[model samples]
Target: MLISFAMRRILLPVLITTGLAALLMAAACSTAPQPLEKKSEPTFDEGEYGGEPLPGTEQVTIVEPSPGGDRFALIRRRTPGEPSDPRFQLWIVDRDGSNPRLISVNTHDVAWHPSGDRAVVTVAIGIDFYVYTIDLETMETTQWTGKESQRLSFPVVSMAGWFRDGHRLLVFANQKAYQQPFPRGLYVIDTRDSMTTGPLVKLFSTTCLGNQDRYTVGKKYVRSDDPSSGNFARYDFDDESWRWITDFPKDSLRFVQKPVPSPTSDLIIQARETGNAKQLFLMNHRGKDVRQITEFGGDIPVWSSDGSYVTFRRDVHRGEGARYVPFKFNLKTRKAEPLWPVSPDSVPDFPDLSTQTLDKLKPRR
Candidate 1:
């Protein structure tokens, strides 16, 4: 009897201690931090052209998305089998790849109006290019620039963007005067009245930040100034003057290009070269708080209309000649994701082509 009581007392304490240890371990594990579940990358199928497989000789490039993010503009080029002029086609489609329609043929460049109801397209004939406005609702096109003889003579003309009011178009052209050297400058044309074109600046190699009142123009060539340096300025439409924003330095190593302002006009995104690779950077409008955004290397970083996202072309293969894949970066999440499929074979197949026929397409005037 004495031995049995002694054994029971020892066994009870041991069982109690063992149970407490397991309970403590379970509590710790339940309260501990858990690893985050990895998210699968979003997949987008290759887009079709008029519900048909994209030809091998055709290349499609996404230009810009509308302000409302409902529609986007793209450029399609068809390379000829023989050595002849390649065909350029401009297309506009919804974000979901619906309502794919041809806007114009032989279009050089295009920019969407802020209202997303129209687009400004540049058409080239021979050596001359003219700007025209297309009403998306009516599909009626109007030549914003006057007749060929009265229009400014420039070997190249590009549509920049619309002013804050969306009534005027900002353009960049090369002005070739009689018996004088050609000069490239930025000019603004009133859409309501195309006859009124006002010169904004007299600088070469200039580019405007779409949806913003700012532009980056090449600096005056001085003996001491670096030949690659450029100037960023903001245009005041009220007074028709430019206010200097900052200077983008050019050196033996890096060349700055495409300084685009965010939709809110508080941030700017630009590309800079380090060694042989180009990377994207984000900075304030005043040229402060500069920080690198990408490390793999990207170019042509264009902000979304709402400033919520940025789309850029990422160099996937360095050995290849400028081979690129498109990606989107979310500002809120600070994450980069693939925007579209990299390979042409991965493009999604269309279910029905009955409604999407090229016969209904109209030619550009």
Candidate 2:
């Protein structure tokens, strides 16, 4: 308190210099490089699995061969733009890849009738979560859902598939999509009714239906990730009960997809992630008997009507871009071939499937 003028001046500069040095040191440390921290996956996607959507080409094309295997119902992007449009235009192409006819726009999913002439389509554009049946022969569209467009009957609803009776269509409703408790799962809607409103019965409760869910058989349904982890389970219509097919280990069940039931109704064929390769496997309806069918990469596994073969989609890169082209795999012969070729019609319609499609695939010997 009684310091001299020279002593005070010298001490003040020293204090100021020290404060500046400390601040510089902290700044240098803040800018120094640190190890990168891996971002953690959310619990929903971390331990729990199943219901992984097919990447890339899922936004471009989805080809569903008619039950008769003589025609293909294709939901293809009208144009591969910069952002990649979510809306798809449904087209019908012959088994030989001829006669490509544009069916509908804003088509989310299409489940064909057993006769292959008709399809139940889901239009999920904007407020239009409407499901309808389209007649290919007449090019006529009839709205099945959303008769009372003023309100939503269910928060989450999509056409699963047409039942064997043809008059009934299976619809999947899950409130879990809105982060709400699931009060609905699978139900039946009679196209026999003009408005498709009443008499809709709730079959059971399944919360994990990924976006653009695909359902084929009512007796067999796939699950999305839930509390423990997502495992493929079969729903028994006979017993009106849920049966867990938890034979496989939890990790192996990750990314299991397209559990298409075999024509015999015993074995289920699906594609799953194996190491780095996406391969095919056959499992029992109860989720046992997991046998590896192919070591090559395949996705969207579709079993033939007779169950002798599987048609799948695999990524193919042209000089222009990457495409998920269709390919056929013979189970008995253990051979893989291109399912269909891109038609080079002067017009996009009236396409053709050629053997050269395999050139892009380069099937393994």
Candidate 3:
């Protein structure tokens, strides 16, 4: 009787094992690997800028003034054909909507020269920084890529503009090769000679982000004993001198938009940060005309031809929602009014120069 009981127990366990094996085999056969459903890549079309046209503006760019009167230059990124990977193509409206002409297809960043006859741009593939000159007359593009590597460098050889002479171009080539440090300095490139100046000039060499001192082992973005502040400096090639604009305070918020130097090189109109707000300020040739124009603290101020009005986009952050509000400011009345269909995804269109700065609007010092 004991032997029979043991045999029964063994048979029961064997039967359970056989059932489980059969169930597993059936599941494996039923679930043969299926081919992956190819995911269609997101496509960005040519006219697909994510914003409505500003009211009274037909997707046209706003024109600010330069050295000459009524010189219009607009830049828009368009992937005209069926896109594999998107690249930015520049278009210029030199005659103000007469006919938009294609400038270059491989351009990454483009800015008109003070003369408004040419442009300075950076063209990069993956890690290379190639500074190129776009000739407006011939629509011919010339690139300068030999001096630097194309690594994912920080301070990214961005911020190009015509110097005081309009004969030379200034480029900020980021040599750090990473995002950890601020840009090393400004590099002055002669357009005619194609000669570059230096690897350092003390302009934006400090931390752009406000946290710099807490350099611990696991800490990110904190440099050891970094000043936790930023300072603006200008290199005078003529005098071989360096000047300080200001040392950004720790508790104070500050940002320097493009430094728009005057025709006479005596003043600069800057988009700056005050506390949590961004506003427009004009600095005289002596760098002292720090007067507040409009108080729409969140938007950037782009000057108009006569410095009479400025156009900008404001970001309104409300809890989980955000809205991009386009605005135009009249300087004489000190009033800012909203423009067009409001959307959180809308952004600023590339601005161009329509009229030139006549005279410094006597600084309100």
What's the TM-score of each model vs. the native? 0.66, 0.63, 0.53
Model 2, span 1-365: residue lDDT tens: 13345433321211233332232233223333232233442122121222222333333345677878888777765443324432466767778767676667677777787677899877765544566787777766766544434122533556767666677776665334444333345666677764243223243333212111222332222444342344455555545455665434444444355466654345566676543445676555565545555544567666554455667765543223334556777654556666655543111342222211111101111
RMSD of 3: 25.0
Q: Which stretch of 10 consecutive residues in model 2 shows the poorest summed lDDT?
A: 356-365
Judge candidate 1 at residue 148 and give its lDDT.
43
Q: List the residue pairs that clash in candidate 1.
A: 46-347
Q: Tens-digit lDDT track for model 1 on 1-365?
A: 01234332321111233333332233223333232235542222222101222223234444577888877676655332323533566777666545567666677777778888988887776566667788877877866543544344443556766766888777766544344233456666776656446455665334445334544332332222244445555554456556555543333213455567765446667776543455676655555556555656666677777666787766554442434455676665556666655434211122223333332222232
Query: Under the 3 Å rule for N, CA and C atoms, how many clashes does model 1 have?
Result: 1
lDDT of each: 0.54, 0.51, 0.42
Candidates 1 and 3, the one with greater lDDT: 1
Q: How many residue pairs clash in each candidate?
A: 1, 1, 11
- Candidate 1: 10-residue stretch with minimal lDDT: 44-53
Q: Which regions in candidate 3 have their CA more than 4 angstroms from the true location?
A: 1-67, 77-89, 94-98, 105-108, 124-128, 146-156, 164-166, 178-183, 199-229, 250-259, 273-277, 285-289, 297-365
- lDDT for 364 (candidate 2): 14
Candidate 2: residue pairs that collide = 327-339
